[model samples]
Target: PPPPPPPPPPPPPPPPICQDVGYKVYRLVPKPSVQDKGGDTLELELPSPRSSILDTLTNMLCATCKPLDTPIECLIEDALYKADGEIYVLGRISEDDLIPFRSHKINLDGWADLHLQDFLNLGFHDKNKKDNLIVVY
Candidate 1:
């Protein structure tokens, strides 16, 4: 009988390339202070309150219906100077609702202050010193 032909060589593997062709970046300038409603509310004390607030905003953005087909990359831009007792709630707020009230003390009060080390740990670099800003890409 004729000798069996040698088995064919295996096919070459695909090239080392990223699956994501491109990315759509979205920046969120979160409020420095988030309302502390008290009673078992998870309080995240961060060096940059804006970063924490960004998380809440990101979650809300994710929950909403897809506005675009392309994948989104949410970026957080941290800014200093806390807005005294500024509580950020999840949900849509009308323009009229944004009016400032005379009352200083509200149900949601308190600020999560983050420091240099904390920002570094969270993969944010100091974008500006004078303005006190940190950014995460």
Candidate 2:
């Protein structure tokens, strides 16, 4: 029999010209547990929400992939929350937690968690705060 025909070429990427390519908006709605207990109108303003963390986390944590552009978030054996110009860390994170996290055994959710504004208050924004207790560069 004769050979099959070749497949079509892949589509080109969208142009770089200005266009309303639409946007993705995220809202920090309370979880089911919180919503069930929410009696009144509770408002919450979340801080620096990234478009995606799974891919970045998977690459950085599992593989040796190191992204330079993303902000640095790590944990150290300390009690204070460090939010310098480069990194973010919650309560102390010693070798115990760091080892597992580095090995992809656990995730960063409970022990290390804070809204965007809170983190920025310690890092860059430095605005809309009272005393600036968080400490930023």
**Model 1's lDDT to the true fold?**
0.35
Q: Which ranges in model 1 have alpha carbons more than 4 Å from their true place?
A: 31-137
Q: After superposition, how far is residue 34 of candidate 1 from its true place, in Å?
A: 18
Assess the local accuracy of residue 89 in candidate 2 as a C-alpha lDDT between 0 and 100.
Answer: 34
lDDT of 1 by residue, 48-84 (tens): 3334655544433333322223243322133211123
lDDT of 2 at 74: 39
Model 2, 1-137: lDDT tens digits are 98998999999998878544565434564333322336766654443332344432433332222333444443443322112232333333443433332212122232234344443333433345333322221
Compute the lDDT for candidate 2.
0.35
Let me know the TM-score candidate 1 reaches against the reference structure: 0.22
Query: Which structure among the candidates has the greatest TM-score?
Result: 1
